[model samples]
Target: MSRTAWRWSRRPSAPSSPRSRPFRSKPGTWRRCSGANAVMSCRSPAGRRRHRPPEEATMQPEPITCRLIVEAVAEFYGLSIVDLLSHRRPQRVTRARQVAMWAAKRLTTRSLTDIGRFVGGRDHATVSHAVRVVDELRERDADFRQQTDDVVLAVEATARTLARFHANGPEDVDPVAVARRILATPRGVPIVSIPEITALASAVSAQELTDSSKMMTGPMKRFRSEPRDRESEFDLYRAVAEVLEADRALKQAQWTHGERGAQARLDRGLKALRETFERETEHVD
Candidate 1:
């Protein structure tokens, strides 16, 4: 018998079976896979599982409810809902309460009637009245408008954060201080105006350029030989004009000469002018 060489060929190994199929993820971690199936599994500490896609999170929370809104408004303004809902007409308290009611209406989704009931059991009409009053006041009073705006913004921001928490999400919002800073700029005031700029420039120039000659001149000297009871209006006017002219001349001389020369000339001129005026005025009196 001839012995023929026999070769053994290795066949492909059988495919391994998947022991455990992909598991379902928790409520927030569900994602679709290539197999067209939803997978729900968090990565293990041992790093055996594949990474999961992050879920889209909600931003801010829903606005505050009517009741909570009223409470927040009351707390911010230091007034009870009862006081706010009251029919009392005291100016300060009434104004504060009206502002609170107005804020509650604006910051919540509650119906007007519901908001009124939450705020001291007021009627819808009362709430409407309050809001109107506050609106009118805000139009007229800058301080009141600013105060209301601050409280409303704070409450609304907090409400939004709470809403985000309820939705199991996070939101990025600018801080309240940033909003306040933006709003704090003075309203209805121009940043620059030609008339105002010109006026300011003129004032600055006047302050910088002061004539010093008049200050260096000696005081006017007056000599009256007799007491004058009354001087005519024309005579008074002429005397004043003469004194003013002498003063101008003294200043002009002072501007040109040294202090000693200016002083001597000013004194002599003032004395002679004073003597003449006094003598004439005494005769009239």
Candidate 2:
């Protein structure tokens, strides 16, 4: 009979050769040891030694984005991206939509409500229902489950491809140039409506509530508590400023470069956002 000597030490575990390694714990906190002993964690619950490759244990694939997942799922199920996002409910379109919801929920950090917004403007409850329906169908029908799996697999592949492309894409791309191009676009970019808000707050006299008001002159109007309070809310001021700047640029582009519809929709969306906010200003409690 031959006997083998195994030396175990407090170091990062590896499939080959015992060597010094940095533990994932606090710096210089690992115990130093040397002997023909094995790490207890090296053994599985079944009493078998388990070894995993470094990549398998520590390397995680980049997160797949919601957009890529939606595109891939739609393509895999033979549905157009429009059909996937549309309010239509043909059986085939519905299945693809459900699978898309499932994939977005599984692969992205976006909330159910966000998933709903992307997938046909449904609510979080609708997204939850779609996910549940897909789960039950996967459990009850093998073919349906396989189809869902295929979509998921396809999405994963698409994400990896996109990750690779982005990783290798231009590192020196100029953000200024990008901004110029977008601002110069005749139709402009897609618009996201600003939050509809009423008066942010009403001016109220604090004198009624506190003696401090007596020391102060005038109504002690409830001015903003903090000058920087707007920091927490959407930067409507900055956005409006940007739109104004963009509008000026667009007008120049139209005048000099013969651009048309440069600020048509963009101007309308900004105006609506401002009007809504002005009308919905918050009131004193």
Candidate 3:
């Protein structure tokens, strides 16, 4: 009715609107907002697709190890691994052992000497003879060839299975259980010597374990007196000293930094054990 009232009324009637409601995603849709400006992404649970990495079909299989080949051959011939490695000259065991050596030669990159050492405490000559024997038998005897083929096939299948297991996240596999199964040494076997060795190691004094140089004096003297005949004895003594030294290092590491620190020294000891024994000096004298 008045000038001020007419001016307010004439000015665009406050843009007639309904009350504002809070922002919401559509029914069955999930929403997530991020960033300063609140950018949002929405997806319906029913229509959502999960993304996954593509399967590695072209992944190469794990390499076949000598241990795997030996175990496979042993199992194929219905013989225990220990029997295969033993010096027994029974027909079945000899054949199985020979076949295992041959398979190890074919499947792994280990030297013949290494194969011999692993199969038994044998030398390279023994392994060479075994390989030749297996080759000759396989070539002349069809039945033998067939049997060897079957053993190789079993080994390959085992390798594939292992590869698949590792590729699929082998977190479920217990390493200790696997080792126990593979190293199932029977009662009264030479494995009993392990306890004897442990006892001997325990009998070593703290001074001897710490200062291996002191332990080496007697062995070195014998080695210097008879470099040829006493060589093996001296070597054995050196090995004991090395073991004691390793034990000292491990104990020290455990005391200073715990198991994690000691693990490195333990690995070094194991590596030393796996290596071929050699004298630092050919003739101590």
Model 3 lDDT per residue over 54-88, tens place = 33255466687666776688778776544565565
Candidate 1 global TM-score? 0.35
Residues 1-285 of candidate 2 have per-residue lDDT tens digits of 223323344445657534555445665434322111234345444445676544435545557665567668766876555456655556897888888888889877889977776555569998999899989998999998888888878767665555555552112122233435656876966332221010000001111112221312222233233233555235534544555565455536643544345445445645554553343344422
Runs of candidate 2 with Cα error greater than 4 angstroms are 1-60, 167-285
Cα miss at 213, model 3 (Å)? 40
Model 1, span 85-175: residue lDDT tens: 4444557767766776787778656677766555544689988998999999899999988989988887777676666456422221222
What lDDT would each prediction earn against the true structure? Answer: 0.54, 0.54, 0.60
What lDDT does candidate 2 reach at residue 262? 47
Which pairs of residues collide in model 3?
none
**Candidate 1 global CA lDDT score:** 0.54
Which stretches of candidate 1 lie above 4 Å from their native place? 1-57, 80-89, 164-285
TM-score of each: 0.35, 0.40, 0.41
